[model samples]
Target: MTQALPSLKDHCRTTVAELIRICQDRAVRSALRPLLAGIPDMQIRAMRYLPRNAPVNQDLLYLIAGLVAEYPCSLPEPNNVMSFGASLYKLSQHPDIKATGIERRLESLLQLELDSLMQPLHSLVVQFSSTQSSKTSIVIDYATLLYHLRCWDDSRKWVQLTWARDFWCPKEDGKEQNSDETLDIVKS
Candidate 1:
């Protein structure tokens, strides 16, 4: 009998946790500085620690690591609650975020193709961080994002559809829809 390979999601979760741990040390955190520049450079230092077997390519992983590092505050893996799309939705709904402004940004995000996703996505995440109230820290589910980036080329385009659903779907009973359920719906 052969052993099952680790799922990409699991790999991503471990990778993210390790990055956060390594960043806890000031020197190690400083090494990730290449990721902070407006445009990502191929020489990002954190690439050494990220798993090479991830479904997403090294460049995408580096971009994700940069985004995650932006939030130096506590990084807790929530129960599939705060995905990139869901977090954007929450940010769009924040009283401080003007509806027209956020709506335009969300539109641009939803329209991106895989080749064009990185920069715009980075900008949107930075926008979310800046526009959000100080009382609440930024939250983005990097593990799921890794999986989505890998699946960006799916014929059904489920990843983009899921993000659109999360952003545009009407809230039911003042509650956000479960992100997994939203994805399943997009898949079907």
Candidate 2:
């Protein structure tokens, strides 16, 4: 009989921890200082304590990319959004990971998880379009995420939807209050 391997979450935790340890050397820090200078110290500390069994998300992916980018070791490709997406696409094509068994592809699982997270925002957009409430903030937040993710088409769709319904304006004391900071951000 063969022993079962650890879960993907466990594997990811171990891999990240090992990578962090490798980058802890003085020489490595000096080299990485320029690139990592913009990242907060709190976030760096939090990386050390990432829960081993927790589900992955975009934030975790960003942190992992940041850490991987700073490593001096050679990788098949640079640690950037394109390379990350390519790696995920490659993983999605694997036979075992693609098999409809107990274990699914990591990319597929992550995509499903992300879609679930976005569902609430989609619902909020639909509801606010009809009701014109303060919940328009959710649509703004969703648009911002899309912008950062480089989904320009979807981001524009949300911005257009919000503008079409004039949801950016809030009625205050019988006056149309139109001081939405997010509107400025989304427009640019």
Candidate 3:
């Protein structure tokens, strides 16, 4: 069985010869086919090798890596998903990237948006005083929450949350200033 195995040089030569023959097939224009067929055989065979483990010259490896992975692509950035960044970007951009677990993020953004819509929420940075039996009350900023829900493309809920319209950003120096926080929305 080992004796039947062809030498690397012989295999390389045979591959080049076959490729040259295929490229020169009569169906194609004779003048152009021969010129295009002139590519180095070594390069063609390299495709077969590099693709396995990114196995050099391996067609399967290269082609497989070139494809898109769907579901996981919808996940947000900086979480550092995917073996390659470019591939991850391409995956996210795929048309099939539907609303998966993004609803939870939507919920989070909605809460934030509601907080933002309300009056520049008291940050309690400059503490004044605490009352007797100082109860720690937490206010859910529903208005800002609605804004995030709106931004999340839950436009159907727009009518439901429409009656609730308010947006306020805190300011220093008594001047209008853009809020420092923003939720970057990505369409899934």
Candidate 4:
């Protein structure tokens, strides 16, 4: 029989080290120095590969949660943030991990995103409404994000607005789609 492959832990560690090296490159560091300033060196080193590692290990999840708590403003790039969130979402759905630890960090990250938006509900509504073309999916996403953030009043307002728009606006096929299911999900 052939020798077994390296353990996942060892593979992850090597991947993380290579990722750290990329982050530490002179040109990369020069470009990212300002963004990295407030974050602790150790946290930055771990966070550079968090999107890759967080899905595979609980320890990495905890480390990332701690780093986010310490440096709420030091958000990763949008793509990385999306990947991180997706990983956490997957982990949170696992029966073994559900409600044990990952849920809390996922909630914290959702709150962090809401806090980062930094605009009141009225402003967000106005901003999205004033655009020449409104994307229903984006409106729904914002409403869902607010719901997850526990901004009940704001979320309700958005759901109502979105429902009204869906009802009143002419559909491409001249038929109105019921948005009650979407509204119910947000209300919950």
- Give the alpha-carbon lDDT of every model: 0.65, 0.34, 0.25, 0.34
C-alpha lDDT of residue 93 in model 4 = 38
**Tens-digit per-residue lDDT, 90-186, candidate 3:** 2223344332322232233334443242111111100111111234321222222222223333444441222122111112221112121211121
Alpha-carbon deviation at 150 in model 1, angstroms: 1.3
Clashing pairs in 2: none
lDDT of 1 at 133: 60
> TM-score of every model?
0.78, 0.23, 0.17, 0.21
Q: Provide the global lDDT of candidate 1 against the true structure.
A: 0.65
**Tens digit of lDDT per residue, candidate 2, span 1-188?**
99998754344445454445545565544433333333555446445434344334535433343433333222221111112222223322344333232123322323333334333323222332333233311112211222323322353543333422232232222111223454455556
Model 1 stretches astray by more than 4 angstroms: 1-3, 36-46, 49-52, 72-78, 131-133, 170-188
Residues 30-71, candidate 4, lDDT per residue (tens digit)? 433332233556445545534353223433332323322222
Clashes of 2: 0
The clash count for each model shown is 0, 0, 24, 0
Worst 10 residues of 3 by lDDT: 64-73
State residue 74's C-alpha deviation in candidate 4, in Å.
Answer: 21
Which of candidates 1 and 3 reaches a greater TM-score?
A: 1
Q: Model 2 lDDT vs. the true structure?
A: 0.34
lDDT of 1 by residue, 1-188 (tens): 99998876677777777667766777665556456453444344456755556556766767676666655444444453444666677777677777677677768876777777767777777776685466765566676676778778888878776666667784542223555666676667
